[model samples]
Target: MKTVYFVVLLLVALTYFTTIEASAIPHCSPWRCQQECLFKNFMKGECIQLQCVCSQKIGGIRP
Candidate 1:
């Protein structure tokens, strides 16, 4: 009986911790992408297809 109770408690604790960790992950957005690009000194930043794309000029020309 004690073993079974311990197992259940452990499972509950594990589930709670896992959920907290999952929710702690940062969600990527267009604004986040732009801020990240600006920090990296990029010319422009845009989010495309849920991905961050940074553009930088090369030799006075845009690529």
Candidate 2:
């Protein structure tokens, strides 16, 4: 009985810690990426693989 209780408590603690760690990770959304790119003067922006990817016209030409 004591071992079962300890196991349950350990599982709960592990779950709580994992949730905190997951929430600590940064999130990059498509809209947020676009806004960030626009702020930086980029023509296009997207979130790819949890990262913000920005692109601009080449040689001052609009595309």
Candidate 3:
């Protein structure tokens, strides 16, 4: 009887877990893009594209 109860409980847990995997995959780049946009403030734009871009500005400009 105890073994039967354990099997039923395991089935319920497995069913619930299947639903989780279905929703967990990365579907598109749009979601990734938005997440990346939020972190833009942390990175310097020049360091990304140019080979010799510096983090420091000549006159402390915001841009």
Candidate 4:
């Protein structure tokens, strides 16, 4: 009975965490771009053709 309870509790915890929505760092770029991107709440910070690009936040798993 105790073993069964532990399994059920773990499952519930995993399900609850998985359902939570969050953002992740999909792209990592240069120092300058990264600073600006995170400061502005952008998800992606990259140097595209020698230009710094700040994209909107994308949904994923991030702490």
Candidate number of the best lDDT? 2
* Better structure of 1 and 4 per lDDT: 1
For model 4 the TM-score comes to: 0.39
Ranking of predictions according to lDDT: 2, 1, 4, 3
Model 2 Cα lDDT, one tens digit per residue, 1-63: 999999999999999888998778977889989988888888899888889999984347558
TM-score of each candidate structure, all chains considered together: 0.45, 0.51, 0.36, 0.39
Model 4, range 3-48, lDDT digits (tens) per residue? Answer: 9999999998887766653223343358889788888778778888
Candidate 3 residues 3-48, lDDT tens each?
9999999999998888888568534344444445445532332323
Which regions of candidate 1 fall more than 4 Å away from where they truly are? Answer: 1-27, 58-63
Q: State the C-alpha lDDT per candidate.
A: 0.80, 0.86, 0.52, 0.75
Select the stronger candidate by TM-score from 1 and 2.
2
Error of 1 at 57 (Å): 3.9
Ranking by TM-score: 2, 1, 4, 3
Question: Highest TM-score: which candidate?
Answer: 2
Cα deviation at 56, candidate 3, in Å, is: 46
Backbone clashes in candidate 2 total: 0
Please identify which of the two predictions, 1 or 3, would achieve the higher TM-score against the true structure.
Answer: 1
Using alpha carbons, what is the TM-score of model 3?
0.36
Q: Model 2, residue 9: what's the lDDT?
A: 100
Candidate 4 lDDT at 9 equals 100
Error of 4 at 16 (Å): 58
